[model samples]
Target: MALTLALESSSSSRGEGGGDGHGSCRPRESMFEKVVTPSDVGKLNRLVVPKHLAEKHLPLPGAAARAGGTVLCFHDARGGEAAWRFRYSYWSSSQSYVMTKGWSRYVRDKRLAAGDTVSFYRDGARLFIDCRRIRRAGVVPAVPPRQPQQAFFFHNQQQAAVQPQQHLVVAPRVVVVDDEVEEARRRRCLRLFGVNLELELRAEPLLLDLQL
Candidate 1:
């Protein structure tokens, strides 16, 4: 009985130690953090990167505007694991703001064009920006001017002396009728008949001679 009690006590101690070791071996938390959605910002506010922003040096809004900082980290939309750094400076030309030094490189890498939008949000001390590309209007292909189409009119052989064969070139004209006016006219014409009948019904009008 003494030997059996000793064996049971040893087994219990081993089981408790194994459980504690397993708990301690758990994986650490992820480095990447969750970003706040644009909707959460009142009025869905975001800064739109102008055409000039990519070309000339410009001052971007900083922490006051929720975009200013000395260093910003850009996370890949595919996955937040990949990140790029952008160094910026805060200064006051007219007012205090943050200007990104290496923003041009990021713009070139993303192939961002004028009218594209970008928004920035903060995760603790880190600043992150999201980009949205705008589709530019394509250049319209030039259409060559159409040459006039000559329509030949031939006269009867017997009447060739009085009337000669002639060529006529007709210029195309587009006529636009006001829908409101046309509808009003149609209503008036229907009311004149004293019965509601389809406009296809055509009747002759009577004429009287008034000669004294």
Candidate 2:
């Protein structure tokens, strides 16, 4: 599968993209179209994919609390111990715990390897990832270079939390988002990159009792 793009979401439709070859899009219906104009619709929220992670990063729904914000981040078993770097703008409070991108310093921090579920905590402005309990999936996420054709390490976990107390989405992936981020943020994510990807609007997990 040539290392297909990875996607994470909780709502909306469309799973991760490996390139369907056939472009499948179900447009807006009549009345809904009347109320929402193309321009206004054009200004709707879109997922922000990093330039390096565009085709590779999938916009999926966030996972549930019981399951922890964890998903089987698909990867090509091709590269061994190689650093796969991608870019991202957002990360759930927990996923943002580890260092997104930096030369070093996170030596004490636990890396987000495959199979390992990460727990996050927000002490102040920054979100801290739990470095102790992550069970590595044995595959390492490779980092990219700025010299072009190289891999990037910055991948974003969209900002949307889900309420475990309510009905779950049941979808493999989901997103946790802030109310302030509307379509403007979405367009910027696309404009900042260059390709259009699927987006699902899901709830973020409540930030209460998160002492961990």
Candidate 3:
């Protein structure tokens, strides 16, 4: 079956199968992506995977695995193993498949929020998760500009404040060739003598020599 795994929106591509191993192996292509919702990044502490994608791509937990949920190892975008293994389980009450256990830590470290897209890919037995952040128009930075560090000393009801470090701004020095500077000076003199600057600038050496 053809898989729509490209990172591009609504694009599809076929990828070669990889060996079934873990550690340091990157997936050839993405399998599918899900747009994050508020609940996914909220206090729910779990991520709800689409039933179709979960059934097709994720391995179903057996009775033993279901006791606590199967541990699913996932690699980050850089192909490195994620810090924690996610627990995959079917939630009968919600009638959905969700990633639990380590989901909240993943969301926190990745700083994922609603509207961000998370793509899933598999290479052999290794699975990967990549995040694509949605850009917001006219969004201001949360942290203010850093101010100079302050040092305060208090002794015998007296306060002494340390001065802030001085920042020096060095202007760029222009390099001028002596010959070019002299040529420009001569040109200015010629212009003062009613000589056209353009004519002098464009004048051929042979023509100027002849005129001279």
Candidate 4:
């Protein structure tokens, strides 16, 4: 008596034993014979690089791009909602090349100075595209923007103005975990150790905006 067996083959090539007899479940994506060309690279930039003027430079005849000391004047992802400003001297010193095909939200709102650099990365023909500010746009925020230290001061004043939590003593007692085994496990998992622990942390939540 003979038993029949069924197998799933994912190899790109069709050969003996259904999969070159290698008995490997090749990645399905590899099996897909998608052809990549200059046009395809351009499409990737049009997709992930976000909608901008510089993306127009994609399909740049390469799979990727790399630029040195490119100033990130503003990036929706790189900077917070506010498009921060940077020192002109920093970028000027690099003498870097800027990508010109696309302009992201940063370029539009920050009104970056001409000579600002932004490099675009993509697939296929367009990999690294340079962006530069041929002209300034929008109202430049300030030579050096204000810091959150002001907010910290305001919060401190308001907090001080209000009466502090009344100091009170409570009877010390042991926590009972009669039927909370799972709860104990969750508490144990979430507990950060030593340096990871904080109580009413005084640390600022975000980075100092570096426009340099």
lDDT for 7 (candidate 1): 17
Q: Global CA lDDT of candidate 4, please?
A: 0.25
Which candidate gets the maximum lDDT versus the true structure? Answer: 3
Expressed as tens digits, the lDDT of each residue in 96-143 for candidate 4 is 223332332223332222223333322222122223222222332222
TM-score of each: 0.30, 0.16, 0.52, 0.16
Task: Return the TM-score for candidate 2, rounded to 2 decimals.
Answer: 0.16
Candidate lDDT scores, in order, read: 0.30, 0.24, 0.51, 0.25
Per residue, candidate 1 scores C-alpha lDDT tens digits across 82-149 of 45566644434434333345554444444332334444433344434445433223221121111121
Better of 2 and 3 by TM-score: 3
Candidate 1, after superposition: displacement of residue 193 in Å?
67
Q: Which stretches of candidate 4 lie over 4 Å from their true place?
A: 1-57, 60-106, 122-212
Q: Which ranges in model 3 have alpha carbons more than 4 Å from their true place? A: 1-27, 138-212
lDDT of 1 at 89: 45
Lowest lDDT 10-residue stretch of candidate 3: 188-197
lDDT of 2 by residue, 1-33 (tens): 132223322224323311222221111111100
